[model samples]
Target: MLIAVATYNEIDNLPIFVERLADTLPNVDLLVIDDGSPDGTGDWCLQEAKVNPHIHCLHRQGKPGLGSAIIAAMKYAVAHDYEVMVNLDADLSHPPEMIPLFLEAWEENDPGATVVIGSRYIKGGGIQGWPWKRHMMSKAINFYTRWLLWLPMADCSGSFRAYPVKLLKQVDFDSFLSQGYSFFEEILYHLKREGAQFVEVPFTFVERQYGASKISLQKAMVAVGTIFRLGMKVWFRA
Candidate 1:
């Protein structure tokens, strides 16, 4: 499996995050997609990639959104013949330790199972170090999405996930509309339509220890409208 992390101004977190990821999955390769960050995150990744053969970095000219970065990374994984791809936050919010469990779930699942999500709303899963407002916002977003789209997922908004490369290749990436957080749920909606089996593993999500969250109140409000538009599209397709 190839682990992919999209980074933008994550200089403080990348070094230690990559170190721990290497310790957790010694053999798996890592792909870091860095958007041009004035903080020199791309430079750091390039320096590390030179010494570590398992670490690969893709540099973008500017801060393209998360969806585009992941798409690019997935393409790289596919072109490189990787059978599985795991994506997590560049920040420490998504624990590197839970990576093994994601791989285990993907390996042990039925042949049709293609996406395994690290869920915070499931049993034994929750978030730590978040204020009550943020927690409620996350819960409400998940609930709203699940209810409107008739999604069976507990964490549709989470980015921590593992995907089978073959299954991902089947999706029309160019048609995906969202370029930010909305992509999380949109991808799952398409996967569900493709009859891809989904599995959720309980995992505690930690708040980012290094940088500030990219999510803004404006983005959150925009997401509500985006979700409704996406939901309508999904409903019509079904």
Candidate 2:
């Protein structure tokens, strides 16, 4: 398995996240895709990779967006012939300890689920530290995405997910329209078209303790537009 994290100016959180992940899953390889953070987050990852054979880093030019970073990681995983690729946030909001559950779910469902999501909207799942407005925005986004994209899962927007590399290799990353957070739903929509099966495992989402959120009103509007366009495609097909 290749565990990946996309980061930007997450120096304070990356170290703790890495340590916790390493403690939880020491045998897995970790890849850090950094967007040239001015705070030297890439530098720290490069330095850590030098000593830790299990750790790797890929430094990009600038803040390109989370979607591209994840797509890059997917290509890397395919090239390396990893069986599975797991992605989570670098801010520790997605707990590394829950990774084993994802893997277990993926295995138990052998030839059943192509993706396993760490869902916060299912039973036994919840969120902490987010304002009511943030919660409403999340709920609304998930509702619309599921309704429009025809995704059956309860959570469609979270980044904590495990994918089969074979299924990823079947996807054309270059064809993706979403270049930001909406990539999550966009990819799932495509994967669903490929007859992919999904499994949702419950997990709590804790707010980041360090660094600020990268979400913006502009990005949210873009996501809305992208999903709407995709939804229209679904409508036309139906």
Candidate 3:
């Protein structure tokens, strides 16, 4: 299995992240795709690479969108012939302990499962550290997406997901237009259009305790616009 983390300015959390993954996940190849964080995240990964044979790191020249980082990781996963390519953020919001949940879910429906989503809206799933305003906003977005796009999935904005390589290859990477955090939403659309089997597993959605949030006024507006545009595309096709 190819386990990949897309990182940006996560140097401080790298050590702890790796240690937690090492303890919980066994025999998984660790792939890090760093977009040239000024804090020497790539450099730290390079040093760790010396002793850890399962760890792989890619350092880009500058900051790229998370979509590109995961796409690059998928290309590498394809080159390595991995059956499943899992992608998650390096911000510790995605707990390393949930790796087994994803593995079991995938195996139970293997050869047919296309996507396994680490969900925050299913049973045993809830968010912590988020204010009521933020939580409501997320739920509002989820509801709008479900009504507009007719998607039944609870967390349309989820980033922690695993895809069987074959299903991923079905997506037109070059044609994937969304570059920001909206990429996750776009992927859900593509998968839905292709009739990919999606499984949602419950997970605790922990808020990031460190580092500044990348979300901004601009991204928020863009997210709304993207959803509207995607909803239109889907609606008109019907």
Candidate 4:
């Protein structure tokens, strides 16, 4: 299994992130996709990758979108012959400890678990430290995506997920339209269209403890528009 984390300026969180992953998933290889963070996050990953054989870094020239970074990680995982690929945010919002549960879920299921999602809207799942406005907005986005895309899952917007690399290779990732956070839902839609089976695991999403949010009003607006266009495309195809 290959675990991938996309990072920006997450200097404060990287140490604990590496330590916990090492302690928990000692055998898994890690790919850090850094988009040229000004705070030396990429440099730190380079140093660690030199010392730790399990750690690898991909440095970009500038800050690219979240979607591109994960796509890059996916390619790396496939090229390296990893059976499964897992992606998470680097700001500690997605817990590194849940990796075991994801693996277990993937292994226990027969054929219907090509994708396992860490969902926040499920019964046992929840979020922490977010203001009511942000919380409500997240809920609204999930609801909107589920209805528009006719998706079965509750948490379509989440980035923390595990995918079988074979399932990932079935899709042409270069055809993906969304270049930011909206890519989460768009990719799920594409996978569902390919008849990929999915499982949702409940998890508590904690707010980032370090640095500011990468989301902006402009990005949110773009995501909304992208969702609408994707909805139309899927609806017409159906």
Candidate 5:
């Protein structure tokens, strides 16, 4: 299993995230995808990599989209023959301890369990620190995405997800068009279209305590446009 994380300007959160992940996932290999942050996050990763053999970091030139970082990690996992590739946030919103639950779901070898998502929509799952407006926006986006893309899952917009590399290889990266937060929604739709089965595990969704969140008001525009655009592609098979 490869635990892949996407990060930007996470200097304060990075070390803490790394430590927690290390403690929780002792045997799993970790891959950190760091977008060039002026906060010296990339340098911090380099130092950590020297001490921790299980930790690896990929440095990018600028702040690219989260989807690109995930796709890059997916390609790396596929190339290296990692059976399971787990994608999560480096901001600590997605708890590292529950990773075993995800792995156990895949252990069953059910054809219907290709992607296991850590979801907050389930009974034991909940969110924290989000304003009512932002919270409503997130709910609306997921609702619209579910209706438009027609996925059976309740949580379609979370960043904590684990994919079987074989099923993940079905989609073409060039066909994946989202460049921002909507990338999570788009990829889930694409996975369904390609016959990848996704399962959602209950998880508590905590807000980040580090720097600012990546999903600002600007991402709302991208989310609205990208959702419909990708919806048409999936709904109409365009």
Candidate 6:
């Protein structure tokens, strides 16, 4: 199994996150995809990768997008012959300990799930530190995505997810349109069409303690537009 994290200026949180993940799953390989953080996050990752055999880093020219970073990770996983690849935020928002549960759920399921989502909307799942307005926005986005895309899952926008490499290899990453947060939903839609099985594992989402949020109002609008366009395709195909 391989674990991947997409990073920007996450120098404050990346070290702690990496240590916790190493402690939680000591043997798993880790890949860091950095988008040229001027704050030396990429430099830190490069130094760590040189010393830690389990850690690897990919340096990009500039701030490309979370989606492209993840796509790079997926391609790397496939090329390296990894059986499974897990992706989570570089910030400490997603718990590393829950990764074991994700692997357990994936293994225990009959025939195994192709994608395992660390969901915040499920019964045992919850979020911490988000205001009511942020909470409402999240709920609204999930509901809109589920209804419009005819998606089966409750949490459609979260980034903490695991994918079977075999299934991921079947996807045409070049054809993906989403180069931002919308990639989460777009990838799932494409995978679902490829007959991928999905399972949700509940996990608590803690708000990042360091640095400002990377998400913006403009990105949210782009996500909404992208999902709406995909929804149109779904409707027309039906």
- Per-residue alpha-carbon lDDT of model 5 for 150-181, expressed as tens digits? 88888988989889888777778887778778
What TM-score against the true fold does each predicted structure earn? 0.96, 0.98, 0.94, 0.97, 0.95, 0.98
lDDT of 3 by residue, 39-126 (tens): 8888999898898998999988777787778888888887888889878777788898898889888988864445899899999888
Which prediction has more favorable TM-score, 4 or 5? 4
Pitting candidate 1 against candidate 4, the one with the higher lDDT is 4
Give the least accurate 10-residue stretch of model 6, judged by summed lDDT.
105-114
* Ten-residue region with minimum lDDT total, candidate 2: 105-114
Indicate the residue-level lDDT of 74 in model 2: 94
Candidate scoring better on lDDT of 2 and 5? 2
Lowest lDDT 10-residue stretch of candidate 3: 212-221
lDDT of 6 by residue, 23-46 (tens): 999889999999999999999999
| Window of ten residues with lowest summed lDDT in model 5 | 105-114
Error of 6 at 41 (Å): 0.6
The residue-by-residue lDDT of candidate 4 on 160-222, one tens digit each, is: 999888777778888888888899999999888888888999999999988889998789888
Runs off by more than 4 Å, candidate 1 = none
How much lDDT does each candidate structure score?
0.88, 0.93, 0.83, 0.89, 0.84, 0.91
RMSD of each: 1.2, 0.9, 1.5, 1.2, 1.6, 1.0
With a 3 Å backbone cut-off (N, CA, C), the pairs that clash in candidate 6 are: none
Clash counts for the predictions, in order? 0, 0, 0, 0, 0, 0
Candidates by lDDT, descending order: 2, 6, 4, 1, 5, 3
Which scores better on lDDT, 1 or 6? 6
